[model samples]
Target: MGSPCLKTVGAPSLEELRNSPAFPKSEDFMKGPIAVIECIEEIPCNPCETSCRKGAIVIGDPITNLPRIDFEKCIGCGICVAACPGLAIYIKDYTYSDEEARISFPYEYLPLPQKGDVVQLIGRTGEMVCSGTVIGMQNSRQNDRTTIVTVAYPKNFFDEVISMKRIKNKS
Candidate 1:
């Protein structure tokens, strides 16, 4: 097994992240929303597995094993999106629109972005990629205070946009 996920301040290398089997195939991704787990190194975590009601995510045996997603079983409900303690899990809907794709990620910050708000989409690194609209937001006790913000952007940016930052004040 590889070393633990303690390198680079928990920021996974995109090259390494793409190597994980958790990424969905083009056909599967274009069909609908699916979970894209970027959990790289082996770590002691399994919230993604337990939160998946469809048994799509499994971190069997060692609790430190990296979580894996069964694209066939994942319904793209975004349940694991907020349950992940490492903030590694994300939801991607390539077919959100004819020209746009939706990307949902866990956000833990005050003054959360509200629906209809335009936010700056950021890449894996902290660089701003493009502007996206806050199409949806999920917050509940079950989410453990982690808000799942869904943003819609150009389909071509599916791989470039992973997270976003609110540029407006809370409503």
Candidate 2:
């Protein structure tokens, strides 16, 4: 069989990080499994490349290909959430509990909700399923400017929710 596209290399070298590895099939890390994207578009993004405290994510020489996040070093601190422009980067902790998990993502809406606010959680396709609670909101110095909001949802909905919107009332 062909080699596993990307294997865990202990503390890759600068050259190794600068060079791109034959990335795993996007489908593998794309939707099902919990993941964090360093950046979605090619554009010009190094914040994720440099913002990583553990050197988990890498953007190679061309800086156009999608970043590769080393699942090993990720600490789930949600730092990269502030660095991503497409608001694609997220901290997905599928191990929040034996039965539940937390999905932290970027929130850029007006009248930003505070921690403990009950909100209707929507899926990537904008379908609202269950409710989630805001557990944390960080806009500290290290985050630059983007507000990182951590919400806790049912373990079953972990893969379903990508972006969330406030639920409006019926008139």
Candidate 3:
């Protein structure tokens, strides 16, 4: 019998993210916080659509259709980020400050970083781009096992910093 294909798929590329209709524009970032849907593959899923209390996410009749975000209704609550099974949803706030931006993602790992902890910011391709600080974190029963972590980084790196890596053994 032939072995089953075991190739693993990596995260979406920068080009893909920039080209996706779901990705917000420069003006969209300035309007408070918003969701950046990294989900490109048309998989059978709709948790993100159902999780939005603001009714921001829309996935037509077909369950496999990609989730669409209505920026007008999105409140950047970050709830959809934790609800996505593929871990593809992210929340970004460019208005955090004149020099800094905020990025929130679903975290499901041990030793969660505390507020004020400096961490290495990672890009979509899993590469360390810069250093960021954990400014906020939330984990509630509603979020299930996924912890939402918010990191602050240089405003210029807002588009590059997608995830954060906690520094090990600070001591």
Candidate 4:
């Protein structure tokens, strides 16, 4: 029997992401909280659009279309972050503080970090960029098992951080 072929996936480059229509602009990021759809592929999925109760996420016509987020209508609830099977949705709140920002991402793993716990912020390419504090975590039944973890970091590193890793204690 032949083994299944595996394809290696690399993080999207900044230039590539900036060129995408789905990526929010600098002005959009500065305007309160908003949804950042990182989904780059054209897959037949619409859970993000359906999960949003505020009707902010729009995937019109074909289900394979990339999600279009109406920033003005988005409430930054982070519900869509957990609902996305691809883990492509994220919520960012630049208004958290003048020096800091909050990012909510879908997490599904053991030893989940709690509020106030210090964690290592990882970028899209799985590289550690900086340290952040866990500000909040939500794992309600409505989330269907995906836990959403919110981390706060310096506003300067907002564009670099996408996820977090729990810090381990040295023996």
Best by lDDT: 3
Native-referenced Cα lDDT, model 3:
0.85
lDDT of each: 0.83, 0.64, 0.85, 0.82
lDDT tens digits, residues 1-171, model 2? 332222333222223323534222335333332345623335766677777788877877887766887765666677767776667667776667666667777877766778999778775445686788888888888776677777877888755666568645446
Q: What lDDT tens digits, residue by residue, belong to model 1 across residues 61-154?
A: 8998777788888898988888887788889998888999999899988788879988999987677899989998888788888888988998
TM-score of each: 0.88, 0.72, 0.90, 0.88
Query: Which residue pairs overlap in candidate 4's backbone?
Result: none
Clashing pairs for predicted structure model 3, backbone only: none
Lowest lDDT 10-residue stretch of candidate 3: 1-10
Q: Is candidate 2 or candidate 4 better by TM-score?
A: 4
Residue range 1-171, candidate 4, lDDT tens digits: 322211234567655666766788888988877888887777899988888999988887888897787777888788888888888878888889989999999888877888999899998778899998899999999998888998889998989888886545545
Residue pairs that clash (backbone atoms under 3 angstroms), model 1: none
Q: Which candidate has the top score in TM-score?
A: 3
Off by over 4 Å in 3: 1-9, 166-171
Off by over 4 Å in 2: 1-35, 38-41, 167-171
Q: How far is each candidate from the true structure, as Cα RMSD in Å?
A: 3.8, 9.7, 4.7, 5.0
Candidate 2, clashing residue pairs? none
